[model samples]
Target chain A: MIVAEQKPLNEIKTMIADAERVLLVGCGTCVTVCFAGGTKEVDLLATSLRMSTKLDGNGKVVDEFTVQRQCEWEYNEPLKEKLDDYDLVVSLGCGVGVQTLNEQFPQKQFVPGLNTAFMGLPTEQGVWEERCAACGNCILDKTGGICPIARCAKQLLNGPCGGSQNGVCEIESDVPCAWQLIWERANDLGQIDRLMELQPAKDWRTSRDGGPRKIVREDLRLVAHEEE
Target chain B: MTTSTNGYKVGSNLERMIRSGEFVVTGELGPPQGHHAEEIREKAALLKGYVDAVNITDNQTAIVRMSSIAAGAIVVQEGLEPIIQMTCRDRNRLAIQSDLLGAAALGCQNLLCLSGDHQSFGNHPGAKNVHDIDSMQLVQMVKNLRDENIFECGDVIKEGGPRFLVGAAVNPFGDPFEWRPYRLAKKVAAGADFVQTQLIYDIPRFKEFMKRVVDMGLHEKVAILAGVGPLKSVGMAKYMRDKVPGMIVEDRYIDGMTDAITGIEPLPPLTKRRKALKAQLQELGEDDPARAEIEAELAELAPRIKEIQAERNKNWREKGIQMCIEQIQELREVEGVAGVHIMAIEWEAAVKPITEGAGLLPRPNVGSNGSG
Candidate 1:
C-alpha cells in the first residue's frame, strides 16, 4: 500500500491558477490506494478549483476524470482526446501516475496534487503506517518480517544500537524498535542463534546508491523489429 | 400575523421552531456499506420524529460508501430534515457543484462542509484521494449557492435554488491546540454559519477552548455545537485513548471503572489509601531520611492512583445521563455555543434519553404535518 497525503489546498490552487482549462486526473493505482489520487478525489479537487476560481473572478473552468491506472501507457491512451482540451493536467495520482501522464501528454503540463509518501498499510481505519522502503532488496528471511530500512531510525543492518530504549525507537514515541522486533521474532521462532551469525556488509550495486537500474527478462523479450 | 422569535426573523415556519430553544436533535447516519437502501431507510425512520435532521456522510475517509446525495434524498422522503455532508475527497469543483444542485432538488437544506479523511484510511487501500479543494472552498461554494445560485457549469437554475444552513467541523483537541481557534476563524470567514467540533471528553479543557472562542469574538458570527459520543465500554474508552488522535480521556474516568469491577466503593478505597500513605510518609520523615524518601514516593503514587480512580468514577456515572447534562450546561454557559451534536454512532437510540435528561426540548415535530 502506498501512503500519501494531499498537499494543502492553497498550494494546489496556486499550482494551476494560470491554467484556464484544467483537467484533474486521478489514478486508480498505488496513489489511489494511498488516497492521494482517485476518482472521488479528482472530482473533489476539480470542484474546489472551479469554485475558488469563480470566486476570484477569473472564471477558470476545470474538468475531472479518473483513469483505471495512470502509470501505464495502455491506461493513459484513453485520455488522449480529453488531454488536448485542457491547458494543464492536475494529477491526483502518485509520483508514477504524474510522470506517466506527463510522458503521455507531452503537450499538456502535469501537476501533482499529492505528495507521494511511502509504501505502507492501513494499521486500522483512517491510519496508514509506512512499512517498506523498496530498497531494491529483500532481507526478511534473515531479520524476520520487520523491515529495518523503514522502521529503524538508523536503518541498521546489524543488531539494535544503544538508542533502542525499552524496546522502542528513541527517535519517536510511537515508532517500535525494529531491531528489537526482529530479535523477538527470531527468539519466538527458536532462531535466537541466528543473531550470533555476523553477516557481512550489504552490497549497494543493485540499490539506489548505484544509480538507476533496470531488469530485462530475456524469456519475455520480443525479437521482431519493424522488418527492415 | 407571525412574529420574530429570539430576534431571528421567522422566514419559514421551521426557523421559528428552531429559534424557540426546541430539542433540536441532529443525528449522523453513515452511508450504507454498499448500494442497498433498505438499511438506510430503516435508520432514517428511527430518527424521523426524534431528530430535527439526519446528516448523510459522503465518502468518509475516501472509502466508497453510499452516495450522500442519494442518502439525503432517502431521509427527506422519510419526512426528516437531511443535512448533506460534502467532502473534497472524491470530487473536483464541477461535480461538487452539480451534486449540491442535485441535493437541493432533492430537498436537502442543511450542508456540512469537510476536508475528508485521507484515502489510505479507507477499506480500499488502492484508492486515490482528491483534495483539490479544502473545507474553506466548500464553504464558499455553499455561500455561492445562497447568493448567486450559479454552479461551476456556468448554468443558472430556474427554480428551487439552494438555501443551505451551512455547517463545518472543527477539532479543538487536535495537535497544536493553539492553531485551532485561527483555523476555525478561517472557516467562519469562509461563510460557515455553524461549527460542529470533534468529540470532546475533558470538560475543563473544553471550557478553556470555549474561552478561546469567546476571546476571539466568534460568538456573534457563528453558532458552535459541541460534539459528544458516549463511551460504551472500557474497551471503547481504551481504544479512544490509545488510538484516536485529538481525544483526551481524563485519568479519573479510567480508575472509576477499575473500582467498580472489584465490587468495592471507589471513594472509600481511594481516600483511605491516600490518608494511610500520607500518615506513613509523615512518620518516616521524622525517622530515617532515606526511608522517608521512599515513603514520600509511595505517598505520591497513592494520590495519583486516587486521582485516576476519581476520574473513572466520574466518567462511569456521567457517561449515559450525567455527561449529557454537563455537556448541555457547558454549552449553555459558553458565550458562543448554540447547540450540541450527539454522535452516538451505533447508540442512536440512547441519544433521546440523554438529551431529554439534559433538559433539552425535542425538536419541533415538523414531520407531524407529513411533509418534510
Candidate 2:
C-alpha cells in the first residue's frame, strides 16, 4: 500500500493562506488505512484550521469532503460541483490523488496536504516499513522473496557490502540487513546454489531511469472496429 | 627478482610480484578533498620504495575528493605505480567504462573495483547514488574489456582498451561467516586477479577464512592481499571495535594501546600545574621561605610538560606501528596469504615505518621489463 503522512499544520496553513474558502478533501483508500488523510483526519484538520485561523483573526471558511478513492476518476465525481465553491482545494491524499484531481478538474487549484512516503504495508500496529521500490523489473524469486532494491541501503545485488554484521546493517542496528535475510531464506529453502551464481549488472531501463513509467494493457482497452 | 615468467596479465609491478610468488605490499593513499596534486605526490613519495603499488582511493568514505584516476596519474609521475580504486556508487556502466579508458590511458595499470561506502555515510547525504552495477558485475565487465576487447554492452573496442590488473575486496569478518569464502570465489570467478580484504584484527577468524579458501583451491586463482592498518590510538581501536560494522578489532590491541599510555595523562601538565600553584600559593604565607621552593617547581613545569606529552604520543604511535608489524609478520605465515595492503589512513608516514618494521622495505625493483 502507498504510505504517507499528513504535512505539518503550519506548512499547510501557509499553502492556503491566501484563500478564503478552503476544502480539505480526503482519500478513503491507502491514506485511510494508514490513518493519514482519512475522513477522521480531515475532520480534525478542518477543526484545527478553523480554530487556529480564527485565533489569528483571519478566519476563513473551511470545509471537508471525503472521496471513496481519490486516485480513480469516477470516484471523485462528487467533488466536481463542490470544487467550484472553494478558492483552494487541499488534498489529503497521496501524490497521485493530487495530480489526478488536478487533471480531472483543470480549472481547479489543488495542493497536497500529505507527503507520500513509500509503497509499504504496516509491519506492526503503528509502524510501517518499505517493502518494494517498484523498480519495474522484479528479481525477488532469486533472492528468496527479499527485495534488496528497496531494503539494502546501497541496493547491492551481490551484497551484504562488507558492512553487515550479525544480520544487521551497518547503517543502524534497527534495520536488519536485507542480504542477511536473503541468505537465511535461501539457506532454508535449500537454494543456496542459486545465490552462488553471479547476478549480472541490472538493466535499469525498466526503472525510473527510463523516465516516468507507463503501462497499457491492450486487452483491457475497448476500441471501435473501423472496418465494420 | 625473477622477470615475468610467461603470460602475466597486465604485468603491473604488484601483479608481477604476486605472479612470481613474492609477497607484495600495497599501500593506500587517499586523495585530498580538494584539487591538491601535491598532496598526492607527497603521499606517493612516502609509499614509493615501500610498497609495490599504492591504491588511490576514489571518494573514500563517500566524501568527494580529487578523482582517483587524476590522483593515480600524479602518483605515476612521482615514480610510483598506482592502483586506481573505482566505486559503483557514483557512476553507471557508461561512466565506469569511460573512466576505465581514461584511467588506463593515464598510466594506471591496477584497478580495485569496489561497491563504495553508501553516500549517506558521506558529506553529501542528500545526493542520489547511481549503483547501476555492483562491484561483481564491474569485475566481470573490466575482465571482458581487458581479455575480449569488448565493452560491457558487447560492442567491439576496435582500439586500445583498458588492460587492468583487476582487483576486488573481501571482508572475512563480515556476517554469515560461512558465505565469506564463497564471496571471494565469486569474485575470482568474475575475473578478479587479486583480492584485498577488509582490515584483519581477529587472526583466528582470518585463518579460518584462509583455510576455506585453500581447501577450495581458490588461493591459486587470485592473489589475496590481507588488509592491515595501524591502530593510531586507543580511541580509534575502541571506535572500530564498538562502531564500525563488518570490522573485528580484537580487545587485545585495545588493551595493548591502553597499556602504551598507562601512566601518562593526555592533558599537558600546565593545567595541572596551574591548579597546583593556585592551591600552593593560597596555602603558603607571602614571607615563607618554602614558597621559593614551590616557585622553582613551577618554573620547571614548562619543559617537563612538553617532555611528558611528547612521550605519551610517541609511546602510542610506537605501539600502533609495532602492532601493525606483528600482524604483517603473522599474516605472512598464514597458508594462503599472498601479501599485505597497509591502509595507514591519513598517516602516510606510518606506512614507511610499518612496512620497514615488517621487513617489507627495499621493495623489489621489477624494472620495466614485465609491465604490460
Identify the candidate with maximal DockQ. Answer: 2
Off by over 4 Å in 1: A1-228, B1-23, B152-160, B256-322, B364-372
Provide the lDDT at A219 for model 1.
67
What does candidate 1 score in Cα RMSD to the true structure?
24.4
TM-score of chain A of 1: 0.93
Point out the worst 10-residue segment of candidate 1 chain B by lDDT.
B1-10
Fnat measured on candidate 2: 0.76
Q: Give residue B58's lDDT in candidate 1 (0 to 100).
A: 87
Residue B371 in candidate 2 has what lDDT? 43
The CAPRI classification for model 1 reads as incorrect
**Model 2: per-residue Cα lDDT over A108-223, one tens digit each:** 89999999999999999999999999999999998999999999988989857899899999878999999999999999999988987989988888999999999977667798
Give the residue spans of candidate 2 off by over 4 A: A224-228, B1-6, B265-307, B369-372
Q: What's each prediction's TM-score?
A: 0.52, 0.93
How does candidate 2 score on lDDT? 0.90
Model 1, span A41-123: residue lDDT tens: 88887788888888989968798889888889999888999887988888888888889888877888999899988889988
